[model samples]
Target: MSTTIEVEQATGPDLTHRLRDAIQNAEFAPHQRLIEADLSERFGASRASVRTALLNLAGEGLVERLPNRGARVRAITVGEAIEIVEVRLGLESLVARKAAENLTTKDAAVLRELRGRIESAANEGSLVEYSRVNQELDERIREIGAHATATQLLERLRAQSARHQFRLAFVPGRAATSAPEHVAIIDAILARDADAAEEATRRHLAGIIAMLRAMD
Candidate 1:
C-alpha cells in the first residue's frame, strides 16, 4: 500500500520535477514544444496532471506557454543571457568578497579539496559531474559568506544559470578552460584576499559572458 501510494505521487508532481530536470539538463531543447498528450503517455500521467505540470514548469521559468501553441521549453535570448551574467557578476563577486573575509582555515582546506575534485571532473570530461561539483563549490562559498538574504537571492539566480550551463557545456573547450578560471577564484578566497577574490569572480563570469556573446 505504501509503495502504491508512492507510485501515485511519483506519477504526479514528481513527473513535473522530472520534466523540469530534463529541461534544465537540455534534454528538452529550447523552443521544443511539449504536447500534453505526449507527456501524459510518456510519464504515465493523466492529461489533467500533465497540464497542471506544464503550468508548474512555466512558473519555474523552465517552460513558456504560447498563445495558441501550448507550452515549449524557454529559449534564452542573447540579451537576456547577458543580463543574467551581469547580475551574476555582482552577486558572485560579493559572495567571493564575503567568503574571503569570513573563511576559516578549515573552510580553505575543504575548498582546496573541492577544487581538486573539479579538476578531476574536468580532466575526465564529465560535464554532468563537473556541473555538480561546481554547484557544491558555489554553495560552499555562499555558506562561508554567511549572508542569508544574498545567498537566497543567488539560489534563485542559480536555477536560471543552470540551464545556461547545460547548453554551454556542449561548447568545445568550455569545461577545460573554465577549470583554471574557477581555481583562481578559489585560490583568492582561500588566500583571504577579498579584493582579489572579487576580481577573480568578476573575471570568471565575464569570460562566460564573452563566450556567450561569441556564440551568438
Candidate 2:
C-alpha cells in the first residue's frame, strides 16, 4: 500500500516543503505552469497561501515567473550543478574544520546519533529518508561551527540549487558512499583533528564530482 500526504492540514513550512519536493523531485516538470488556481486545488490551499509558497520558491530560483505564464519549475543545467557543488565543497570544508574546533561532547553525541540514522536509512535504500537525514547531518555540522555567515550562505545556496543536489543524490553509489564519509567526518571531529576533518569533507565532495562525472 502507498502512503498519501494530506496537504489540507499544511502550514507554511509544510506547503513550502511540498513545493520544494514538487520542484526537486520533478513532480512538476520543467517549464510546466504552476497556475495558482490549479495548485490551490491540487494542494488544497487557498490561492493566497499557495502564492506565498510559490513566491518563496521563486525567491529560491526553483520557480520563475513568466511575462504571461505566471510561474513554472526552472530547469537546472549541468553547469549550474557543478558550480553549486564547487561552492559547497569550499563552505562545507570550512564547516567541518570549524566543527572540529568547536564541537562539544553533547554535539558529538548528536552527530553520532544522526550518523546512525543516516546509515540505516541508506542501507534500507530509502531515498526520502536518506535525503532528510543527510540534510540534518550537514545542518548539524553547520550548527556546530556556529558560523552565521557560512550557514546563511549555505541556506541561500540550498534554495537556489536544490534540484541539482537531488539529482546528485540519485546517482549510483552516492548514498552508500556518503554514509561512511559522514562517519569519517564525525570521527575527525570527535578527535578534534581539524586538518583531517577539512580534508575528509573536501574529499567527500570531490567524490561527488567523481560520481557526477561517472554518470556523464
Return the TM-score for each candidate structure: 0.74, 0.78
Q: Candidate 2: where is the Cα deviation over 4 Å? A: 1-18, 25-27, 41-49
Instruction: Assess the local accuracy of residue 26 in candidate 2 as a C-alpha lDDT between 0 and 100.
Output: 61
Please write out the lDDT profile of model 1 over residues 113-190, one tens digit for every residue.
999999999999988898889878988999999988778667656665677666676687889888998999999998
Clashing pairs in 2: none
Candidate 2, lDDT over the whole model: 0.81
Using lDDT as the measure, the top candidate is: 1
Candidate 1: TM-score?
0.74
* Candidate 1 wrong stretches, greater than 4 Å: 1-20, 33-60, 67-70
What is residue 178's positional error in candidate 2, in angstroms?
2.3
Clashes of each: 0, 0
Cα lDDT tens digits for candidate 2, 1-216? 122233433565678778886776667777888899998888887677788888888887788888877898877676676677789889999989999999898998998898789889889998788988887888899999988988877875765566666777777777887888878998899899999999999999888766655555
